[model samples]
Every structure is written in C-alpha cells, then in structure tokens.
Target: MNLIGIFGTSGFAREVGDIALAQGYQPLYIARDQTELDAWSFAGTAILESEVEIYREIGFAIGIGENAIRQKVARRFAGQLKFINLIHPSATFGQGQRQIVEARQGMIVCAGVRFTNNIQVGDFGVFNLNATIGHDVIVDDFVNIAPGAHISGNVHIGPRCWIGTGAAINQGQGDTKLHIGTDTVIGSGSVVVKACESHSVYVGIPAKKIK
Candidate 1:
C-alpha cells in the first residue's frame, strides 16, 4: 500500500489521516520535533520530520488548518514532494448534477462540503466540514473555508483568505461579483454583502472592517 506523508501532529493531523485511511492509503504522520513525536496520538503512525525519506510517487499533505501556516508548509515542500488532494467521502461537488469546473492539488475537502458548478479552486486550499460554495466562485491559493461557511454565487475570493466558521457571503446580482481581496479575514458568523478590502478583518451582520 502507498503511504501518504501528512505534516503536523495535532488532532487535525489525525483527522487528515482518517481521510487517507478512507482512501485506502497509509497515513504517515510527520512530526515537527521530538516533543510532537512523543505526544502523537496515533500509535505506530508517527515519525520525526527529519527521519522522512522520499519514495517515488509518495504524496504529501499539510494537515494544519490555518491558511498562512499551510501556505508556508506547502512552499517549503514544493517541488520536493508530490502534493495531493484529500477529499472526504461524504463531500459533494456541484449541485443539480453539475460539477466543479476546475480544482488544484493539495486541497482538503472535508466531509459534507459542497461545491456548485463553474467553481475554480486554486492550490493548497481547505474546505472544512459542511461548507458550501455556489456557482461561478473563483477561490485562490491557500484559502481556508471554516466549518459551516456558505459562499454564494459570483464571488471571487483572493489568496490566503480565512473564511471563519458559519460565515455567509451574499451573492452578487447579474454579472457583478463580490470580490474579497487577498489576505482578508471574514469573521465567524458574519454576513458579507459587499466587497472586502485586502489585509483587513470584517465582522458583524453586514460585515464592517474591524481591523
């Protein structure tokens, strides 16, 4: 059986291992240091990162949930290891028999996530549990959609954005796309009805810039 190297030693790392198990591949949990190596929850599955040996066709994934850290890890390992997309079994792509138009590698699509048609997803992104994406959405690299977040149609999300838990982004009307600039943060339970600025934090009912 092929082994997938999962970087990180947290509970989420083990959750990613669950995806590997569901896909019938062995999950090799790589620890950053001796402390994590000793504290890893899964017995016989953990190994020090320094002890990693690259095998032909071996795949790697970042099990961490943060967008910035994920991007950092992906960059550090780029061109060195084969990146993989881990889609959970219960996730659905597209609605009404439609499908995602395009997707890239190192994407972690968790259980119950849904993607509507004509969505273009970039590399090394995470779609957390029960998150939904509507049609004509363009998501950039290293974006993280937290659990239960809902993204409506005609939305263009820029790179390294964090869409917090249960946030809802409203759909743009006919030919108008709500643009979320790069490095933005949409706070938890917030409703986004307008375009968001880059490197800012938005929160509240009609998301106002808090930072």
Candidate 2:
C-alpha cells in the first residue's frame, strides 16, 4: 500500500488523513521536530523529518491550515518527498467543468468543493469543505479558502491569502476582476464586494479594511 506523509497532527490533520484514506493510501502523520515525534501519541502512525529518507519516496501532503506555514513546510520537504494533490471524492468541479490551470503540487481540495469553469489554482492551496468557487477565478499559491466560503466569478485571490469560513465575495463586473492582494486576510462571514490591498485585513458586511 502507498503511504502518504501528512505534515501535521492537528484536528485538521486528522481530517486530511481521512481524505488520504479515501485516496487508497495509508496516512503517516509527520511531526515538526524530534520533540513532537517523541511525544506524539496520536492514533495514526507518525514520524519525524529525520526519518523521511528511510522511506525512499513517499507521497506527501501538507495537513496544515495556515497559508504561510503550508508554504514553509512544502518548501522544506520539496526535494525530500514527492508532493501529491489530495482531492476528496465528494468534491465537485461543476457539472461539465472546464480546465483548472494548476501550477504546482500539494493542493488539498476537500469535500463538497464546487469549482466553476476556467479556474486557475496555484500550488499548496486548500479549498476547504463546501466552499463554492465561481468562474474565471484565480487562486494563488498557499491560499486557504476556509469552509463554507463563496468566491464569485472573475476573482483573483492573491498568494498566502486566507478567505475565512462562511465568507462571501461577490462577483466583479465587466472589464474588472476582484483583486485580493498578497497576504491579505478576509475575515469570517464578511461579504466582500471591493478589491483588497496587499498585507491587509478586511472584515465587515462590505468587507472594509480593519487593519
């Protein structure tokens, strides 16, 4: 049986393990360091970074939910293990979906994710449970679209962005696309209609900048 090295031990990690199991692979939880490896008492089998080479080549997945941390762990394990995109069987990419122009590896598309046509998804991103992504959308690398979030058409989500849970971003009109700048955080349950700037925080009914 193929073994998947999941790079986290959190509750979300366990959830990702379930997805790995659905993909017909065994979940091998990866701990951050020797301390974590020594103290790990989780249900699944786990190991430290130092022991990855012994397996020769194992499929890897980042079980982390944090965008920056996901990128960090991915880069650290880039040449070590083979990265794999873990998409749940329950996720739907529209009825007759067009192409998803994916750039790199280790994308985690969870249960009930619906993707519309002509979407461009970058590397190491997470489309969480029940999130809806509309047409002509571009999700950059290391982005985390949290559960129940809705991204409308012509949306450009920047790198390392975290679209919070249950948030809704409305569609952009002709000759314009909603551009969310790099490293921005869209707060949970916010309704965004306007473009967001880089390295900022937006939260409200209209999703104004709070930071």
Candidate 3:
C-alpha cells in the first residue's frame, strides 16, 4: 500500500488524513518530534522528519494552514517528495464543466466547491468547504479561501492572502479585474469590489482597507 505523509499534527492534519483515506491511501502522520506526534491520536505510523528518508514512494500533503508555515514546510520537502493535491470527491466544476489553466501542487479543495473556467491556482492554496471560485481567476501561492466565500470572475488574489469565511469578491466592470495584493487579509463577510493594496487588511461590505 502506498503511504501518504501529512506534515503537521493539528486538527487540520487529521482532516487531511481523512481526505487521504477517502482517496484510498494509507495516511502516515509526520511530525518534527515525538512530543508533537504523541499529542495527536494518529492511528497510523508516526515518524519524525529525520526518518523520512526511510520511506520511498511516499507522497506528501501539507497539513499546516498558515501560509508562511506551509510555504516553509513545502520548501523543506520540495523536489525530495511528491506533493499531493487533495480534493474532495463532491467538489464540482462550474457550468457542469470547466478547464483549469494551471493548478500547482499541494492544493486542498474541500467539498461542495465549484471552479469555473480558466482558473490558475498556485501551490499550496487552500479552498475550504463550499467555497465558490468563478471564471478567469488567478490564485497565487499559499492563498486561503475560507468556507462559503465567493470569488467572482476575473479576480486576482495574491500570495499568502486570506479570504475570510463567507467573504465575496465582485467581478469588476468591463475589462477591469479586482486585484487583491500580496499578504493581505479580507475580513469575514466582506464584499470586495475594488483593487486592494499589498500587505493590508480590508473589511466591511464594500471592503475598505483598515490597516
């Protein structure tokens, strides 16, 4: 049986392990130390980072949610192990069909998600449960779209940005795209209509930058 290693032992790591189980792979919990491994009730084998070389033909999925941490973990195993994209089987394509331009490694797409045409997703992007992504979207690396968030067409989300739960992005009028800058955070339930600057936090119905 092929073993799928999940890096991190948090609740999210367990969730990813369940996803791996659904995909028919034996899930192994990978931790930095024995104490971290002992904290989680991992049913399968728990191994430390130093012991990773013992396993061959193993695929890895980052269980960390934070962008910076996930990026760091991904870098540590890049080219050394194959990254897995864990998508729930129930997630659907827009219009009953769509074509993704590019979807990189280590993406976790949860159930009831919809992806429209011409979407480009970078590495380690997380789309939580029931998130809807519209057409012509560009999602950069380590971007997290929270549960039930609606990302409208022609929207560009930058790297390490977080779209909070139930947030929505508007499709900008004719030929214009809504651009969300890098390292930004969109608050929960906010409706983003215009372009946002880098390293800022935006909130409210119309999505104004507060910081």
Candidate 4:
C-alpha cells in the first residue's frame, strides 16, 4: 500500500487519515517530536519532520486548517515532497457517473459533499462535510468552505478566504459571477448576495462588511 504522511496531529489530521485509509493508503503521523506524536492516537507510525527525508517513498498532506499556516508549509515542501489530495469516496459528482472534478494538490474534501460540473478548485482548498459547490465555480488556493455551506454557480472565491459553516453565497446571473475577495472571512450563517471586498469580515443576511 502507498504510505501517506500527514503533517500536523490535529483532529482534522485524524479525519484525513481515515480518508487515506479508505483509499487504501497507509497513514503515518508526522510531528515535531515523540511527545506530540504520543498525544494523538494514530494507527500508524509517527515520524518527526526532521526525519521526513528518510521516507523518500511517502507522499504528504497538510492537515492544518488555517490558510496562512497551510500555505507556508506547502511552499516549504513544494519542490522537496509530493502533496496528496484526499477526497472522500462518498462525495458525489453532478451526474450519476464518477467524473473528475477539477481539484488541485493538498485538497481535503470531506464526505457527503456534492459538486456540480465545471467546478475548479485550487490547491490546498478544504471542503468540509456536506458542502456543495455548484457549476462553473472557481475556488482559489487556501480557501476553506465550512460544513453545510452552499456556494452557487459562477461564483469566484479568491485565495485565503474562509466561508463559515452554513454560509450561503448567491450565484451570479447570466455572464456575471459573484466574487469573494482575497483574505475575506464570511461569518457563520451569513447569506452573501453580492461581491465582497478583500481583507474584510462579512456577516448577517445579505452579508455586510463589519471589519
């Protein structure tokens, strides 16, 4: 079986391990030290980051949820190691057939997710449980869509944006696309109907910027 090294021992890492196991890959916990490794009950062997060079055959995945941290780690190991995309088997495509969704490296797609056709997802994007992405949606790198969030068709989400749990982004009409700018945070339960500016926090119905 292929050995997959998961960096970070958080709950999300364990979740990714389960997905890796489902895909017939052996999951190894990668940590800084033995103490950090011991804290998490991982099924496979634990190895420190310094010892990672020894495992030349292993592929890695970033288990950190924060966009900045994930981006840093991804860049650090970019040329040195191969990053794996872990998509759960239960995720359903638009049609009945299993067609390929446009997902890039280090993406973590959870179970019960649904994707429509022509969806483009960038590197290291996280689609939480049951999140739905509609047709022709463009998701940039390091974007995290929380559980139960619904992103409509022709939506362009910029890099490092966080869509909180249950947030809904309205689709664009005709040739227009609703754009969520870079580094913006959409609060949980917010309903975004228009374009959002970069580096702002949007909340409430119709999604007004608060910060």
Error of 1 at 38 (Å): 1.6
Q: Please say which candidate is ahead in TM-score: 2 or 3.
A: 2
Candidate 3 lands at a TM-score of: 0.92
C-alpha lDDT of candidate 1 relative to the true structure: 0.86
Clashing pairs for predicted structure model 1, backbone only? none
Model 1 lDDT per residue over 25-95, tens place: 89999898999888876644888888765452688888998889888888877888888888888888765
RMSD of each: 2.1, 1.7, 2.0, 2.0
Tell me the tens digit of each residue's lDDT in model 4 across 30-134: 886788866866567778878889885678888877888889888888889988788899988876313344336888888988888788778898888899999
Q: Model 4 lDDT vs. the true structure?
A: 0.87
TM-score-wise, the better of 2 and 4 is: 2
- Going through the candidates in the order shown, the clash numbers are 0, 0, 0, 0
Candidates 1 and 3, the one with greater lDDT: 1
lDDT of each: 0.86, 0.88, 0.85, 0.87
Candidate 2, which ten residues in sequence have the lowest lDDT sum? 95-104
Kindly report which residue pairs in candidate 2 clash with one another.
Answer: none
Candidate 4: give the clashing pairs.
none
Q: Could you give candidate 3's per-residue lDDT for residues 34-70 as a string of tens digits?
A: 8886776657777887787777477888888788899
lDDT, candidate 1, at 201: 99
lDDT of 2 by residue, 81-188 (tens): 788888888888764452352335898888998897878888888999999999988898999999999999999999999999999999978968899999999999
Of the two candidates 1 and 4, the one with more favorable lDDT, higher being better, is: 4
Our tally of clashes for model 4 stands at 0
